[model samples]
Target: MRQDRKSLAWSTLLEIDSQPEGPLHRKLCGALRSAVVAGRVTPGSALPPSRVLAEDLGCSRWVITEAYAQLIAEGYLEARSGSATRVRATAAVPNQGQPRSNPQISVPVEFEMLPGMPDLRTFPRKRWADAVREVTASIASADLGYPDVFGHPRLRERLAAYLVRGRGAAVSADDVIVCDGTLDGVVRLCRALRSAGHTHVAVEDPGWSRLSSAVSTVGLTPVPVEVDRDGLRIDRLRANTLTRAVIVAPAHQFPTGTVLTPARRAELLHWAREVDGLVMEDDYDAEFRYDRRPIGTVQGMDSARVVLMGSLSKTLSPALRIGWVVAPPRWAEALREAAVAVTPPPVIDQLAFAAFLDAGWYDGHIRASRLRYRSRRDLLLKEMASTLPDLEISGAAAGFHLLLHLNDCDAAQAVRRAARLGLRLVDLDQYRMSARTGPPALVLGYGNLSDASVPEAVRRLAEAVRGKGTGTSCG
Candidate 1:
């Protein structure tokens, strides 16, 4: 019996008793059949018990039983002893003049160069499962109730220590606030800014759209600040007097992968201090640097002016939804107040993550992931150099993605044609807030791409670029 629909109080079913034209059982049967045929009652839906329906419809139990039996004989319903009666799986009629067809399930592309996705195959399932099991077995009864508005204390302490030790951020456990992920942290920060009388937030011109969207969602306008080889142009940001707060990925900027130069970093902090503004540092994928040692965070230098945001989305898995915000002392209270409005991630998961960190599993996982991704990046660079030598590539020094500058080539058209060739690619223009003109480019991500698929994927990409064929192949 489908418990969900067993107590269904369908008006049509109850209305049969008011029908004065035919016998009670016959009327009930006709109404039920019409309901099923008309799609009022969905297929596989449980009908009410005979006694319940009889009492509700003011009819004898035998009448309800007789109608149910008749429907079963007509192949409109099914019944088993000791179970509730249910509509036949195929009893519902199709719409007039329409033929039934199987539901469509979308097939994924064989080779996807989607930016910001980590390879899911490497997730430490056993370790994570063990941590969860251990935490569940040993967690205190009091910890199972409502979570702390800021975060679980143990997780916050672990995150604070980890961030300071790894990312070089200056923060204590009191400054840490756990969030669902980077985007959730962004939203909470935006709301806090709005509450603090902020009207505009400066964002990177060609930046992650979802983060900018989060800014706009909180009723604060996102001012686009151009990013260059040195990272966010400090002079361009200084020009916008109305915008005080800015979000930046200093360790490795997205799309371009340019690290924020020390000079620009100093200038950014200066600007923040001058205006008493905040700098939201999105330290995403900072741990995966391949060419050199990852730069220490801006918050490490000036913790008072910066809010360091990081998460396990890249280092571990997005499914965990574990992220933290190291807020400045001035904004910590406001962010905590904003945190109350959003439901924090599960406390058990938080504790499990703390256990993972405390056990040094997180560090081990990051080291292994860095090696794996670096190999993939090297393979992709080599293939591109061998096949598409004429095409210029940038941002290959670090991170899961790199930029393929399509000089004079139409990136949008290339993406469309690539789709026809069973290749997935993203255009750089999609990330731009303004219609700035430059050589078009594609943001190619090789994180989730398998090593065995690299040669064929690059070959297909070459075909798409060369306008060779229109036929689609997943080879």
Candidate 2:
């Protein structure tokens, strides 16, 4: 009986009640709270009646009531005079979310060079607190009815202005849809495309792997298209007759950091026009270009053909969980309908974000983070040159991460050695679907390290690569 109850709770909270030296009431409360938070019991989902749950757990009725009361006090459960107890709506885990294969599973966290994570330690907590307080006090009570089915109007207006000025996107408040993050935005668009009869979509060959779930979750096939020096291969894109859409990380392609060349951008526009297939452009980190001025966004070339995804996750913090999709006129309604079907982020958080952007606090925070991260990137590059010279580098133009190719070396073995040394690093070959792989490369991220620890981290990595100095080059 306890095992059955434990299984049910795991489906909701991913945590089982610990075997404790406590009374039955405490254990029962822990199990139920864990179950609700794990999403086993969704918002508005009701709980078993107190008596029914008591009978199932083989506990007294009063014991179950007290347990339910504890959950209610903790804000994880709710109760009414006659209605069954229900789960309260609350954020369960941390870091916006992960690939989300199991919404119930706790987000996976280990070496985390999986890509695009911001240095969250640098989040402007003081500024955020001020903004949150201001919004919480100022927002009218009636605004809490439900999320603006289309997203917060104030955020839309602010995001449109920011995108046009900063990212070169063509959008109006009406054209923007707020979402949890890029992956959520993708899920929304993919669902809309499916509704419109789009079955197969193209994704870049060593693209964001999360797309496997985000795109397929909505029942569309993610067709793999190769990306080379120019960007997404136009030849293959043009050749595919069945392609109905495409997803591209054009700003600084994930893991590789290659910006899309101008010619390719034009070619992409031409293809979108000719094929009538929309391009969902993820223009992340366009604000932090170190070498060249960040190029104008692909969405600006033809707003009718491109859907733009931009987020505060890298610019601010992933914990903010605020992102927007600037859709073409055709996709606006479809995206909103899909969002309504799932959990839209809390209204209060959205309002706070809108206020933050409106007050110009968002821009101030971005500029500070950009300067700090740029310094980290430059130091990491210098350290790599001084400490590990044989490594070939690419995708270093922008973003928090850059890839270093170990010349003709055993990438897998090097990664294992680095792991053994407590130095975390990610391999690039795993990003590819085909067996034809790139050189032995490590995707190193720098934004999280303190100034003093940068060199020490590189020093340890160097030792790992040498295998204590056998120094065999992979070339």
Residue-wise lDDT of candidate 1 within 1-475, one digit each (tens)?
2335645676444457554686677888888888788777777788887777777777787577656655764568764323456777657665544433411113237799889889999999999999999999999999999889788999999998988898899999999999877877887787789888999899887888666655654556788889888889999999989999999999888877788888999999999999999999999779989988777899999999999999888877888887888998879989876665566889999999999999999999989888899999989889989988888888738889999887777787788777777789988987787554556888999989998899999998888776666443211
The reply for model 1, stretches above 4 Å from the true place, is 1-108, 470-475
Candidate-wise lDDT, in order: 0.82, 0.72
In model 1, the worst 10-residue window by lDDT is 99-108
Best model per lDDT: 1
- Clash totals for all models, in order? 0, 9
lDDT of 2 by residue, 1-475 (tens): 0123323543234233463657777777776766555555566566665566667666687566656555554456544322345565442524235445552233223333335678877787887888889888988888768767667788788888988887777789889888777877877787689889999888887766556435543456777788886678878887779896999988888767778888888888888888788999998778878776777789998999999997777888877677888888889867766664445567788888888878888888877877787888888789889998877778846778888777777777776666665666777886675443776777777766666777877887777666776556343
Q: Clashing pairs in model 2?
A: 12-38, 12-40, 13-38, 256-395, 407-474, 407-475, 408-474, 408-475, 409-474
